[model samples]
Target: MKTAICYYSRHHGNTLRVIEAMAEAGDAELIDVTARSAVRLEDYDRVGFASGIYGFEFHRAVADFARKYLPQGKPVFLVYTYGGAKGAGAKAVAKIAEERGCPVLGEFGCRGFDTFGPFKLAGGIAKGHPDALDLEDARKFYRSLG
Candidate 1:
């Protein structure tokens, strides 16, 4: 399937690592949501939103992109990395996709190195995460979408 993953990977690039593995395994296109404002995804067979959880949600930019640019009736999927525990990041985006009549195919979440806010004082949480196994799992998740 021709897929495009719109992503925001900041701080430690934890989400980026998983995204890269999924792209390599699935041969999908990557869209950096932070860099682009207008993206056309009509040509893609499936669309994905990926990001590290920020304040228990997908990064604001990513969610905004999905709200503004995601195509109607398209197949959608989610990928996210979190520090302490999995949050509502996936659900937040899925709701947006659903509003556009898109079908949510699946979602994948994993621990990612985090140093945001108070966690920074303790050096960080989920350090050395989105590791080899996590990347492999992300790849497998993407493959299963087909």
Candidate 2:
């Protein structure tokens, strides 16, 4: 399947690592959501949104990118990485897909090193995460779908 993943992987590039493994598994395209121009989602058979969890959600840019350019009626998926796994990032993206009448294939997330706020004081958390095992799981998740 032709897939495109719109992503915003800042800071430690945790989300990028997972997506890269997914891309390597198939002919998936990576569209940076923070790019200068918007991506046209209709170019692919499947679409995905990915980012690191921030403030209990995905980076605002991802939601904005989807709202601005996501086409209607396409199969969508969600991928995210975060220091703390508890967040609404996937839920929000799934809502967007539902609103556009898109069938969600699945959502996946893995632990990522983080030091955004309070955690910074302690150096970081979830260090060495999204490691080999996580990448293997990510690959498995992608293979489970298209």
Best by lDDT: 1
Q: Per-residue lDDT for 15 in model 1?
A: 90
* Each model's lDDT: 0.90, 0.89
- Return the lDDT, model 1, position 55: 80
Colliding residue pairs in candidate 2: none
lDDT of 1 by residue, 1-116 (tens): 88999999997989989999999897899999989868899989999999999888898889889888888899999999999866577778888988899999998999999998
Tens-digit per-residue lDDT, 21-52, candidate 2: 99988779999988749567898899989999
Q: After superposition, how far is residue 70 of candidate 1 from its true place, in Å?
A: 0.9
- Candidate 1 regions exceeding 4 Å error are none
True-structure lDDT of candidate 2: 0.89
